[model samples]
Target: MTATIPLGSRISGERLAVLLGEWRRRGSRHGSTDLAAAVEMYVLDGQLPIGTRLPAERELAAALGVSRTLIGAALDRLREDGIVASRQGAGSWIAGTGARRRDLEIPVTDGIFDLAKAAPSALPGLTAAADAARHDLAAYVTGNGYVTGGLPSLRSRIAERYTARGLPTTEEQVMITGGAYSAFVLCLRMLAGPGDRVLVEQPTYPNALDALRAAHALPVPVALDPGEGWDLAGVEAALRQASPRFAYLMADFQNPTGHRLDAEQRERLGGLLARTRTPVVIDESLVELDYDSDPLDGPPPLASFAGELSLTLGSASKSHWGGLRLGWIRASADLLDRLLSSRFAVDLGAPVFEQLVLAAMLEPAGYAALAQRRQDFRGRRDALAAALGHYCPDWTFTMPSGGLSLWCRLPKPMSTRLAVSAANHGVQLAPGSRFGVHGGMERWLRVPFALPSEHLSEAVRRLSLAVASVRSCAGVPAVNVPVA
Candidate 1:
């Protein structure tokens, strides 16, 4: 017999709860049937995409505030419908769409509105910068083109950037990489190993969690409240108890949460790391997108507070264009050496032309576009908030001072279900469950302002329809059965 390879990322019980909002009808006797139909809706809509693993029965019962018998019965119903498959030891997964597909009335639309990613289009003037870099590339054409550490031009620009942000970085401290995520991978490789505990925010950038797991590093989560911001006491305890090898943090306009660690908070957090003698990788990918104040006038980079133990990651993906595929790491000279030495196992170096393009983008002349990009994003951010207010009145969110997405708290814990229904309405979403480590946060959703205003408005309108559809699903009566 073959061992079970993972079907796909496991959907935690708490996450499944978010997907099965109000599954049972009031006073319905056949709760198992109701639960099964709710689960079936997700499967049919491709929300629980094929091969997606499901929570264990006991876990599901706890999450849904029901009994295991109810969950088991529901699973049985699902299996009968041919929508799910299970093995004794391997748990269960979505297997097929079942025979009900043709009967459902799925809303039709020509194009899908995507709010699943926070990435924006290339900064205006990227083409002009690329053209300038194209001419500059001729000089490097004569060389081997592998600047392992990074091209001096790009490194210096990034170094000065750190200085402006109050880190006092030098050219020697920075190592350019393919992107912020790549920079994270390189650091993860150098600092952690299998079974090692790496501290992280509870609802963090999902990709970072994936990378940490891929490296076999166990992530120790510290709870983060979107409204309240980081809980330093909790972080301090996790550091002391878990003794994580290092922490991964995003203090500036933190992803999905939009909570910035104020200067005082950073000082306190930095001191905690210093006292713990723990190293940290601070992902500053969203640092440049501040909407209210100058990025410089804001709190100093957390690295400045954290001292030598911090490894700071910066990227052009959010500020400029993702296509440039460029980011860099600022670390102590000694740590930078180790990260550089570890690069041999990966590809040679970041592509030469892209690096040059980023270099040109960082030039003094290119800052006008950066400012313009920020203005454009600020407008987009307000547009999304307005749409949400207009279309989803009960969906509450703090107006983020920065960041490309808004973290909205839904009136119902129907994020996953709403996502499935939204897909039918031609709108894509990243539900709150994707951000949590152990699978929860069902009451929330992250909506990006990356689309045009018209598109954003329409998407929210469709989302409002999806919300209604979910309500309709909850209202459908299940086949009668004797109550246990």
Candidate 2:
């Protein structure tokens, strides 16, 4: 005989208890499917938000009057459907929505050590900076305390740092905002509007693309050639063809691909950019995190070449910690003045505490701490590369000397499928298509080795299994590809 499962607790606690007792007697065979169904009913009824944390396993099992083993099975099934996620110690949360339509469960697993996000948390000395910011707060407590225009001291410090980096900047040429994305939004608002063309790399950051859409700008994609790093020739061609009014470039330690434009290319691109009169928005977020090359000493800043035509955005997120939402834009003095006046319409400014903290981090000692972090990241990158080389030979990848991720090009165009398969094995990966312009990077995958060495090795092992799975399904003849 079939058994009826209570939909939710809405029927009253007594009725739920009675119903649970009835279902418990039906045994495991009937209870498992019923439990998953009940969870689905809760989601459909809007009882849980995407990313809502669920109760503890013991508590949930007790409440449902079911064994923990049964609850785990139900959760496993939900996870297969992408309905929920359970971190080993971090508890489970409802996965977010996706473009593809499927019954929601938990989300894709980023690696136990997630290489997806390039940024890390604050290093060891951040507590001292936080303490300093607390002191700074005492003087500002009497004022409005809203940091819409940013703390003056921070603006000056950022400008000074820009000057130190070879790009002459002044306090008037800077404006502090939240992170890089927030800074980009503020600039896009001031520079472009609906129907305006903005050029971006083909395999660009997804959130930035979303921001462009939010700004109502038409996005024109310039493809990045995995073989030659970013396609300089394509960039030039796109400039002439698209005639976009604004553009964004990460010339140093670019995100997915980890490619940096050399001095000559920067110079050539800068001249070409000037002729187009398109304001280039350069994300120098990862500039300080480089690992493969010699420490940057005297090369001209990417913005130096762009001259008045550039707006350079920097952030402490990657160099410091993602938790610190501090980012600044360095532009021509006049542009900075204009942006400052226009910015009030969106946000008052970054939080005063964060500005104070970042300002403290900008000091010489703070930079030394960051240097240590860079060295650590370098070791992790090398370790990840070694793991990949040892396990997955058919896949080709470029070793980004400094950035957080390795942009790997696989032998087959199965990045999306591989991401799905990887989730089944407990490793979440950012698909190559996520980076491509208008969905083009099907053969590429971005992997980061930013986690601890042990997690990096495990992630690589899972990735190799995933690649093998993808290859087996593709049924293509195996061909060797070079990966550094």
Candidate 3:
């Protein structure tokens, strides 16, 4: 008989109930579909990992204030979809590794707007850059193409950009990777291990949290407010108490919430981390996407304030193009050497052609592309905000200074339910719990404005429909319903 490896941990009925906040039947129907859809969304969003043992049907029903028959019906739906598996005597567990296969498929169909991903479309001049790169690639075709630490010329360009941005860097301090995700994983693998705690903001990039989990690092979250920015006191408390192996933060144009740490907060955070000698990884993927008139007004790189323990990460995926798949890490020479030693386990190096294309994008012509993106994004942001105000007035959100998405707080804690309902209305959303470390921010949602203005307006209209369905289910009155 083969021994089954134990799943990470079992979530209690109480915790699961908190995660399934207000998952009532929508669309004026009392059925198991809503419950089933909510669970599917939770699993798909990484809130519920595969192989997790679910609570007993009776226990779950009691916790959710629903009947056991309803819970059974919901589990039946999950089982049919391969989202959950049941045993004769043992119990139920989240099945088939990570998200339903259907949800992962991004279909290129019209009338369906996917607001789940925050990335924008490819920038202008990308084709021209790729064409130029092919010509440049001919020069290196003869030599061995696999350079683990990345191409020297590309690294030099990346290092120069970092130095110009207030942090003195050199080619030796930079290591190129596939993208920002790769850079983060490499850093985490080098710094943390199983059972080690990694400090993070309360709400952060979902993929980063997934990366930390993959590295087996226990994430300790410090509260960060969308309106007020980082809670330095909470961060200090976590650092002093948790003694985390490292702290991963998005200092500029933070994802989902789109809050940037101020200069003073940066200094204070750096000083505290330096005092503790804790290594910090600053994700600057969205740094260059600032919508401000005076780009110089943004906070300086966090590495400028921190000591040797700090490392900065940047990527061309956001500013230039996601298809390019080029990102770099800026660290001291010693740390760079350590990361390089382990880099081979993941990838040989970033593609030579992509590196060349990114290098060209860093030149003067690329600045024009970036400026055009800024203007386009600013207009889209305004359109999204207006649409949200017109369609869902009860919802509240702060205007993001920069970054791609709006972290919105729904009138009630129905983000997960709303996401499930929204999918039925031909719109996809990233619920708030996706960004949270645990599963408690059921009142929030991340609405990306990276799509076209018409799509943004249509998404809001669909969301209003979802909200109405929820209100109808809960017997609440809707005062305003915008005409589509």
| TM-score of structure candidate 1 | 0.77
Best-to-worst order by TM-score is 1, 3, 2
lDDT of 2 at 461: 90
Count steric clashes of candidate 2: 16
Local accuracy of candidate 3 as per-residue lDDT tens digits, 235-300: 776687778899999988788778888888899989989999999999999888889853545677
Per model, how many backbone clashes are there? 0, 16, 0
Q: In model 2, how large is the Cα lDDT of residue 16?
A: 30
Among all candidates shown, the one with the greatest lDDT: 1
Please, what is the whole-model Cα lDDT of each candidate in the order they appear? 0.80, 0.71, 0.78
Off by over 4 Å in 2: 1-111, 292-298, 472-484
For candidate 1, write residues 196-271 as lDDT tens digits. Answer: 9888886788888788888888777666755787879768867876788999999998888899999899999999
Global CA lDDT of candidate 1, please?
0.80
The better-scoring model by lDDT among 2 and 3 is: 3
lDDT of 2: 0.71
TM-scores of the candidates are 0.77, 0.74, 0.76
Query: RMSD in Å for candidate 2, one decimal?
Result: 18.7
TM-score of 3: 0.76
RMSD of 1: 9.1
